[model samples]
Target chain A: MSLIIKDLYARVKDGAEILKGVNLNIPKGEVHAIMGPNGSGKSTLSKVLCGHPDYEVTGGSAEMDGQDLFSLSVDERSRAGLFLAFQYPVEVPGVSNANFMRAALQARLPKEEELDAVAFYKNLRARMKQLGMDPKFTARAVNEGFSGGEKKRNDVLQMMMLDPTYAILDETDSGLDVDALRIVSEGVNAMRAPYRSFLVITHYKRLLDYIRPDVVHVLYNGRIVKTAGYDLVDYIEEHGFDFVKEEHP
Target chain B: MDTPAFNDADELSGKLRLALEQAEAEARLREAETPDRLNEDWRFGRPHIYAKALVSALESDTDNAGRITIQAPAACVEPMADDMRDGEMRLRSIGSDKILALHLKRFGKGICLCIDTVLADPIIITYETEGVFTPSTIILAAEGAAARIIERHIVRGSGLLVATRDIKAMAGADISLELEVSGESTSGSDQPRAMNITNIAAMDAQVRQLTRYSGLDWAREETVAEILHENTTIELFSANRLHGTQILDQHTRQIHSWGKSTSNLLYKNVVDGSATATFAGNIYVAPGAHETDAYQANRNMLLSEDATINSLPGLEILADKVRCSHGSASAPMDEEQLFYLLSRGIPRHDAQMLVADGFLADAVTQFRGSESDGNNTKI
Candidate 1:
């Protein structure tokens, strides 16, 4: 079982293609890091996987365990065990965090069944503690008037609560401070299991130090030019992406 | 068998005389028979009906009574000797369609209760009348000072009550009025009340008012405000809640005669059961009142299968360089908002209540914290 991106092509708005031809397989029990410079389609891949309405998938298919994820709506893809930790999470005014999470959880229940409130809160509090979030955050409106680090940490909180089979985290570490990033990385690592996987997208190699990935991919101009192991992240850190840009061209 | 065509003053005098005679005759009839829901005039909605013996029972008990409290200026204590002038008012038993008339027997010529800012408490007026018709009248005078008044009318059993009020907000004065109506199930009758508020605002004077009515079998509250100066400002807010087959008919007319005058009117109604609520507001900017700014809005919410709301918000502008607009909208509760709340585990009824409370909260907030004259009101 894996998240297979087969000959995937995507465009931003009505512009020319961003993700020209992306092909990757994130197998279960693995953590994959896709590192690239700005505007290299790293974020585009996450949006395409989540079936964002703004992006057009010109050609390609994304399959999770042989079921096409690209064929589903944004919410449907989320229900089908695909999660995207947005770089900038949306602020929904007057909707409390607990209520929003409850809606997301309720969407997963069977037609006749319901989630137990007691169990839901119990699990939610435990997950929140792991992410270093204050208990009071549950009552506040979702992501409203939050600082940069707080919003990033909140994204991790949603990711942990959702517990999807395959998660695409786009720049989840950009705005987080050292402590917040470490805590958020720890929360992500805790969700790692034999049947779950993650594709962490980042511009810098800083986050990889906390949650080591099983595979590393370097992207240049909307294409993955190199694929290696943990050592590739160290190479990209020691030497910047200039060499990669040269290799892709 | 025919009458001659009279001049303007003569015709007006005849009309005034006829109106007073009709009012007195209706008042006498109201003292006798209790009005019921089946009465032709009450074909819309009816209040509670209490037998004449019930008034004696209520008077003897002295325990539970309908309460009303007024707050006004110190000069109100002096007897309004000149207020009974002829041709100043033309009203008759409120109206036959709504409330009946009853007698008010205990009042001296110079009995004036104090309702100054120092009192700081609701001057409650209680009535324990059990008869078919319970007619009551209170003459309020706010002579150049500002105040807030909360007038509450409640009934225990079904009975018709026709009430009248005369308020004078004199030159450079302000007044805020809050009218609340709520009661338990009583036999059906009509509750009609007429308020004639005369405002003589000098240069740069202001007046503001809010009337809130809730929980009555049937209510028809009417008001007429005349602005009598330049640079005068007036605002009127009306909120009504109706349940069962209750019908609420509210009519308001605002007249502005001076330049640079401003007036705003807003009405909100929530109707359930087969209840019906109608709002008719007319704003008149006279010929000489240039630079007049007036606006009116009427909004209604229907909660049940048979509820109805009718709105007629009108504006007449006779002056140049005036900005006047009025709008009315009637809509059901937002189903998408309800679904969004319910999907998050909030029960359907609670969600609807939250939405309804949000819809009405803005109108209620205007009544708190301060009086209409920009002075802080003592709690």
Candidate 2:
């Protein structure tokens, strides 16, 4: 089983098309990394998967685990095990991080089940200590006034807490330092399992060195132009998108 | 006309009777016409809209030893006739507003709060009332005395409430005064209510004032203060939330009478449903009051298209070498922030509240000592 997108086409509400005729399949239990240049629709693909209201899907379809993903709302898509870690996480100024996480976890539970405050805090503090995050952040507003590195780590913390079956990290390593990168990678690796999958979208090859994607794809011009193993990373590091364009053309 | 300040009054003390008679005569002789759309300040506040309602006095506690909390060293606790105090409430709250005159002619007994030592814990005065409740208080902080006083009122039912609090801080006194008012619909249609607050600061005194008003139906609150001495500082914050057919009119004034003094005011409003909220903040710096710093701001958010908010920030500065600034903003919720929360699997209504909590975060943070309570509040 896999998340399959066939000929996906999307555009801004009134602007020019951003995603045009894209095809990709991320099979369960396999980690895939998509690297691309600027304006390659990497962020758009992630947003569309979560049903962002600003973008409209003009044609084609996407399905996850044999269920039509397009039929669900943004929140439903999340409860259906699809997750997108934002590149620029928005600040919810008054909501505490603890409360936000609690609401998110509560949303995932059955309707009659109430969230246990004690267990929730116990698990939250444990994960926070593991991520090297100060416990004070648990009471602070969600990503409000956080530094660039802090925001990225917060994104990873969210991903870890939710534990979605299929997760996409949209440029999660762009603004991170070397130390932050290693810490974030460890957080991701701790969540890696046979039943769960990850689609890592980044611009640099350095992030792949830590997460170690099993399959690598070159997403060029809103389409997966070439697919290979880790060797494609070496080729890109040497010749860049120039050779990918030559091969696809 | 609209609701009468009072329908009729029972027997009163001879002194209070004389003051009421004189105030009634003066109010009638110089009766200002109902400020309709013609007056600039009354553009959003149509004082002509009147509804008839009953009025009565709220029973007072005979022994208030339990009510008056002196967290600091004890000084004096006394109650007096306070006859002329009610008559002055009219001009003290807002010179142009005539509604307070009607209140003075009816009810007139209040409490005087005085502290002589620095307080480690906040002094809380809590009250619950029904019917037409008229409660008044005066706070006095002696020199070098530091204290935090909170007056909280929770009221229910359809009746008018006339409240007045006069505060004074002497030299070197650090004082904080907080007024938290909440009203609920208990029975019938909720009637209009009026509140008046005034504060004065002496030389070298630092005073911070906060007022949190939430209403169902209709409420009118007037908060005003003046820096009377040199080298003093004052800060004022207001937060309001209204729903249903509530109509709220808030008037605030900051006056700097001496140079080398600073006064700041910030007001935030959130109106939902078919409610209407109005805010008017005025800052005045007297001539020759050099080096005076005055600032005022009003921010409003409407939860629905039908809701309305009117904000006016006024500044009158005649002194040179003075710094003054004022701003007012009225807008809806930020859609981008809303989308971000919804994508996290939060329900639609919960997401709306979260964004609202964020919009009012700045004002919430200013509530001193509230953060240490360990309660998760998205205020």
Candidate 3:
């Protein structure tokens, strides 16, 4: 099973086109990394996949395990096992992290079912402890007043809590220092399982070092110009995207 | 009865008539017609149309006994004496003279709550009345005493309620007052409305007041606080949720007459449907009241496109070396915040509710924080 995309085209609502005829397939149990230059529509791809309202998809289709992704709403896509770790997580004021997480998990359950509060808290505390997050954060507002590193860790903590089938990391490594990067990568690594697939989007090879990917694709000018094995990460680290852009042009 | 304060009902009516005449003369001299849109204090409020109805209701003499129920510690409960009522009447008024005069003319029965020692349990007062119910409450906290007072106004049938509270916090005293107004539309009952006017004078004490309104057709609240001595702290908070064309009008004033006093006010409203809310707050520091720290903020979250909010924040600082600020903000729910919650699988309606609830939770948090402190201040 895989998340298949065919000739995807998207653009900002009433604005310039950002993604043009992009295709990629992330099979289950495999992690794929997308390396792209600035303004190459990497972030746009993630947002479009998550059904962000700011952008409109003009053509093509994306399916998760044969189920059409565009057919679902933003929240429906999430409950259907699609997750996007925001590049810049939004701050939700006055909603405690614990309550926010509990609501998300509750949404995944049936109407007649009830979430076990005690077990929820116990599991949440365990996940937080695993991620090196302070216990007090559970009581704090979601992502509010949090530092860059703390926000990233909180995002990973949420991903762990939700346990989606296919996760997209949109520049999750941005603004993270070395120590924070290590901890965040570790959290992502722990969530890797046989039934889950990940699409790690980043600019630098430093992130790929912590959470190595099985395949690396070079996206240039809103299109994937080259797709190769992990060696592409090192090749680009050495030569940059100039050669790929030249070849694509 | 042990020497009734007044000989007969005629004497009581005479005293009330004198008070009403004095109030009307004052109103006439000030050229204060029923507050309308032209009035600065009533610009966004529609109290003018109901002014005649309210006055006529006050003019009607309806005995409203046994409608108010009070559950309090026996030591702190007592009947309001005539002298105590007169003394409270002499205190500076905070609301419009027209309404206060009508309230005074109709005010006959009330509770005089005196807290001389720390009280662990709150004084609960519930008002279940209809058609021009006016009750006066006097809360006097002795030095070093701490107490909590909760007033619940439950409107079953359509009527107008004019309630006034006079609070005095002595040196080193700590007091908290919570007022909740909720109503239901009964069959064949006209619109239900309520006006709450509160006045507070604090001297080297800590006083906190919180008022919440929900499911009320219309409500108007006027609060005035005076800092009489140094080391006094006053916190005022209101969290209101309005739905279905409900209207909430609020007016507040923080007067700093002494130096080194602190006062803060926060009012939050969530207006859904076609409801509307208006908040007007003023912070005034006397010429010599230096080192005064005061802040006022009014926040509103409009849940629907038809919902409206009018906020006016004013600060007049006549003293130097003081720090004071006031701000007002009204906006629809943040799209990014909504998307963030929605992206987590929360349904749209539930997501909006969460954001709206969080918008008002800040004020409740501050009030509850102060409450806990008051609870710990018992000595």
lDDT string for model 1 (B307-340, tens) is 9887877888888898888999999876544543
TM-score of chain B of 1: 0.69
Deviation (Å) of B236 in candidate 1: 1.8
Residue pairs clashing in model 2 are B2-B50
Please, what is the whole-model Cα lDDT of each candidate in the order they appear?
A: 0.65, 0.75, 0.87
After TM-score superposition, the amount by which residue B73's alpha carbon in candidate 2 deviates from its true location, in angstroms, is: 9.1
Ranking by lDDT: 3, 2, 1
Candidate 2 lands at a TM-score of: 0.88
Tens-digit lDDT track for model 2 on B71-153?
Answer: 33344345635554643454464533444444454445455678776766777676554556555667777888777777776
Residue A198 displacement in candidate 2 (angstroms): 0.9
As a whole number from 0 to 100, the lDDT of residue B71 in candidate 1 is: 43
Candidate 3 chain B least-lDDT 10 residues: B86-95
How do the candidates rank by DockQ, highest first? 3, 2, 1
Please give, as one word, the docking class of candidate 1: incorrect
Query: What would the TM-score be for candidate 3 when compared with the true structure?
Result: 0.92
DockQ of 3: 0.79
lDDT of 3 by residue, B1-379 (tens): 5854878899988988877965655454244355556667777776566555666677675665427889899989888776664544544443366666666655666778999998887889998757667888889999998988899987656767778888999999999999998776776445888888888999999999999987678888889999999999999999988988889999999999998999999999999999989998999999999999999999999889999898999999999999999999898889989988888888888888888888898998889888887644431
Error of 3 at A98 (Å): 1.3
Q: Judging by lDDT, tell me the better candidate of 2 and 3.
A: 3
Candidate 2 stretches with Cα past 4 Å from truth are A247-249, B1-35, B50-77, B83-91, B191-194, B197-202, B369-379
- Candidate 2, CAPRI quality class derived from DockQ: medium
